[model samples]
Target: MLDWMNRYRRNRMVDHYITQLGPALRKRYGLREQYTVPQIQKTLVAIHLNTHYLAYAVALYRHEASRNTVNLRLSQTFLDSLRAEMAKRYFHGRDSYRAHDVLGLVKTSRWRGGRSADGVRSWVAGAAD
Candidate 1:
């Protein structure tokens, strides 16, 4: 019984945090939609490459943005937080690393930090594969 209770507690805590992850990412990662599976996969890869610290933050962000999170405005605070998290996860071999794991970072960086909604639409149009 005690074990069950402990597991339940852990799951609940995880769920609670998961619920908050999306809003936080959306607020930070410039919530947008992935028109293609490859783009979606890449963005997911970017988050994974990053610290992935926010306990399902990616999922939450995806849900909230309705897959169009990138189309929405992003906050500097969010981008900074993401960059810091990525720096923590980034290693010496990061250049060879796959960008999909941290799709958010790749998108932001590739755009040179100035691509508007249209730019994102173009990226998403690519095949997710």
Candidate 2:
């Protein structure tokens, strides 16, 4: 019960923050009613984390928008802000491997294909070396 409540609370907070980001984003992009706050939030989160499914969804959603518009809206500063917020909320104080630590191994790995999904997996596996 306690765990469930905590999860629910966290979810609610996420939703709230996403909702708050909506207006700022819409205003930034000068988008009228085409995209809702929830949609924008989901897309931003997807792009920030480089999530496969969500990234696809966001791509589909942006099919109507110009590439320049999409690029400008999903700027690095915005993505980094969202990433930092998410890290603070979910991964604060958590021990994790930094990307640089594995970059050398990944770069040196002999994957069959270059930077494909399977290649990335192989790189990750070989990154232990």
The top-ranked prediction according to lDDT is 2
The Cα local distance difference test for each model comes to 0.39, 0.42
User: What ranges in model 2 sit over 4 Å off?
Assistant: 1-72, 93-129
TM-score of 1: 0.25
State every prediction's TM-score relative to the real structure: 0.25, 0.23
Each candidate's number of clashing pairs is 24, 0
Instruction: Give a tens-digit lDDT track for model 1, residues 22-70.
Output: 2343445454541232343354454443322332233322323232334
Alpha-carbon shift of residue 116 in model 2 (angstroms): 41
Candidate 1 weakest ten by summed lDDT: 58-67
* Cα deviation of 64, candidate 2, in Å: 20
lDDT of 2 by residue, 1-129 (tens): 999987676556454334433334444555443443356546467445323223222222232344443554754344444445444554562213222211212232465665576476778878988
